[model samples]
Each structure stands twice: as structure tokens, then as C-alpha cells.
Target: RDLNALGGLAKLMPFTAIFTLIAALSIAGTPPFNGFMSKWMIYQSTFLSGNGLLVFFGVMALFISAATLASFIKFYTTAFGGEPTKLTQNVKEVSSSMLIAKGFLASLCLLLGLIPALILPLLLSPGKALANVDLSGLITT
Candidate 1:
């Protein structure tokens, strides 16, 4: 929580830093990432409804996404950039098993981002099951 106490960890724990970077960027809703796609789908549905109130909320969601990006940028640059502070100077990378786990999760994130169609049907299953909505049109490349 105290970012002021952290610095230059990327040099000490390069692998961990990379994984954290992926997590940060994905959550920040950067393009071609799952986070962005999820938001896009919600915003698309909201705007398509042509309701002013939902449109306003959708715009607010975009602003929130920007704020998320800014916050994560601060998080990455402060924790991974600059000279190491006393607290982070002796930090070490995690075990190989942990790295493997992180790598698997990171790959999944990238996959979902790059190929949303792969999961869109699975994700929309409940909606289809309940309402039998024709959601095939909502699927985007």
C-alpha cells in the first residue's frame, strides 16, 4: 500500500516484475486485453440500448478505466522503476512453480484478449439459457 517505500524492484526480481506488469496492464483495460474486451462488451450493450442514463454510466465507466490505467502506471513505475529503496533492495524472484503458475495465468489473459470469440459463447451461455437471446450478432472478432 505504501508505494513510497517501494522502488527498483524490476532489477531485483525481473520475472516477478514482468508477471506483475501483465496483471497490471490487463486490469487497467489496455487494448487487446481481456479487461478492455469485457468493458467494450458492456459499453457496447449499454450504448446500443440508446438510453441516456445508461450512456452516461457507460461514459463514466470509460473514465474509470482511464483512472485505472493511471493508478496502475503509478504502481508499476514506482515499484519497478528507479533505484531500489531499503525495503526492496534485497527482494528476490519467486520460485519456479510460482513463475509457472503466473505464466499460465498470464497466457490465459492474453488468449482471452486476443481471441475473445473463444470464450464469448461460454460466457454468454447463462444469458442464452435464460432468455434465448440471439447473441450471435454480439460476437466480434
Candidate 2:
């Protein structure tokens, strides 16, 4: 369906709207999503670094994060609010394969957030080998 021509999110496509909402929440760094965990780690590391400039930038990041959430909320509400437009009146849900693909990605986001340790080691391996450093020793877990 041509979502660009749709008047409201409800009118566009249900499944697509739901998925978009989830993705938007993730991007906004809401809790229980991968984005939140990653952002939290970034802020934590920046604070622990003991660098004044980094701390300032971290604070700026927080502000930007808030702005991002607000902007996305506005966008979502505006796009999904109101009634259907002429072009979107006959819009239908996306195909099953597409939904399955999106679902997999969304679930992956949640899984990574819930158990980052599962993939952290693999992610660090390349960097560890390149630097000839045992980065695993730095992380207690």
C-alpha cells in the first residue's frame, strides 16, 4: 500500500502501523527494547570515563534523546491519527513473509536488549584480536 498517501495510521494498515510503532519506540530508546540497553551502556561508559568533555557530550546526548522521542511521538500521532484518505481506503496488510521478517528483527532487538552477553563476546572478538588485547578481562561478566 501507498502509505504516503494515507491520512491516518489506523487507516493505512494495521500490522504495518503496529510494527512501525514498535520500531519507533525502539529508536526512541524506550525500556525493554535493544536501543534502551545500548543507550544506557553508552551513557554509563561515558560517565565512568572521567572525562569532562565526554560527560558534557553525554548530557547533550541525553537531551538529544529526549528530543528524538518527542519528535517521533509527534510524527507517529500525526501519521496515525484522524480518518483514512481516498488513496488508503483500500489498503491491505503486507504479505506474510514480510511480516515474518519484520517480526524476526523485532524479536532480535528484544533478545539482544534482554541478554546482551550472548552476543557481546562475539562482537568484541574481532576488536580484541586486532588490538592484541584481552578485552574480556575488562568486563566482569
lDDT leader: 1
**Residue 10 lDDT (model 2):** 61
Worst 10 residues of 1 by lDDT: 132-141
Q: Model 1: how far is 90 from its true place, Å?
A: 1.1
Each candidate's lDDT (Cα)? 0.87, 0.76
Model 2 residue 50 CA deviation in Å: 1.2
**What's the lDDT of the predicted structure labeled candidate 2?**
0.76
Q: List runs of model 1 lying over 4 Å from the truth.
A: none
Residue 19 of model 1 has an lDDT of 83
Tell me the tens digit of each residue's lDDT in model 1 across 16-48. Answer: 898888889899888777887888887897777
The residue-by-residue lDDT of candidate 2 on 1-141, one tens digit each, is 543565665666777777777788889888777788767766876776799999988888888889989988877776676787776567777899998888888887778877878877886799789997866665532
TM-score of 2: 0.80
Cα displacement (angstroms), candidate 2, residue 57, comes to 1.2
